[model samples]
Target: MIDQEDLELKCLGLIYTMVQNHLSDKQKEVKAELESNKAMENIYVFKSSTSLVNDMQVGKQGPIATRYAKSNKDISDVVDELQALLSKNSSKEGVTVDG
Candidate 1:
């Protein structure tokens, strides 16, 4: 016959294992959700940035070009530099930019 103390210890150990496994599974789910959210956020930011770039390209020929030609050129150059940096980093991470 099993001793009562030994039986209780075994039961406690089993419960602890079950709880640990459940927590581990929950942690994995949370991590996956966070990764998915981050990817979605990155996509949103990329789209917005590209849209801004397009708008700026158009603005170069608009009234802003005449009023602030030098400033516009400087901002366009900065945008190009940042885009190149983003492209380099994204390529290293296996992300392709369509725009």
Candidate 2:
């Protein structure tokens, strides 16, 4: 003959064990997801950094180099033209003063 109070206590204990097992499984799943996310983040950082370095290396010999060279030449030409104009103006001013 099982007593009512004892039966209730056994049922509560069994429910408690089942809940604990369920919670443990859920905790493991959450931990695994967190680790997976961290690994993915690390991979993304590595790839981005590698790409940046490659781009920098390529810039020295690629289209970026051509662009920079063109810009420098354009600036030099402008500077030369300005100097020529200034010299011509100075010479005209000198002739006016001398005459």
Model 1, 1-99: lDDT tens digits are 235455643211100111121346777686457547843453322211111223334664553442454545545655665577668778999997654
List the global CA lDDT of all models: 0.44, 0.38
The TM-score values for the models, in the order shown, are 0.33, 0.29
Model 1 clashing residue pairs (backbone) = none
Q: In candidate 1, how many Å is residue 29 off?
A: 51
Model 2 bad stretches (over 4 Å): 1-67, 95-99
For candidate 2, what is the TM-score? 0.29
Lowest lDDT 10-mer window, candidate 2? Answer: 10-19
lDDT of 2 by residue, 1-99 (tens): 235355643211100111121346777686457547843443211100001123324575553422454444444554455455456657877832221
Off by more than 4 A, model 1? 1-66
Using lDDT as the measure, the top candidate is 1
Candidate 2 residue pairs in clash (backbone atoms < 3 Å):
none
After aligning candidate 1 to the native by TM-score, how far in Å is the CA of 42 from where it should be? 21
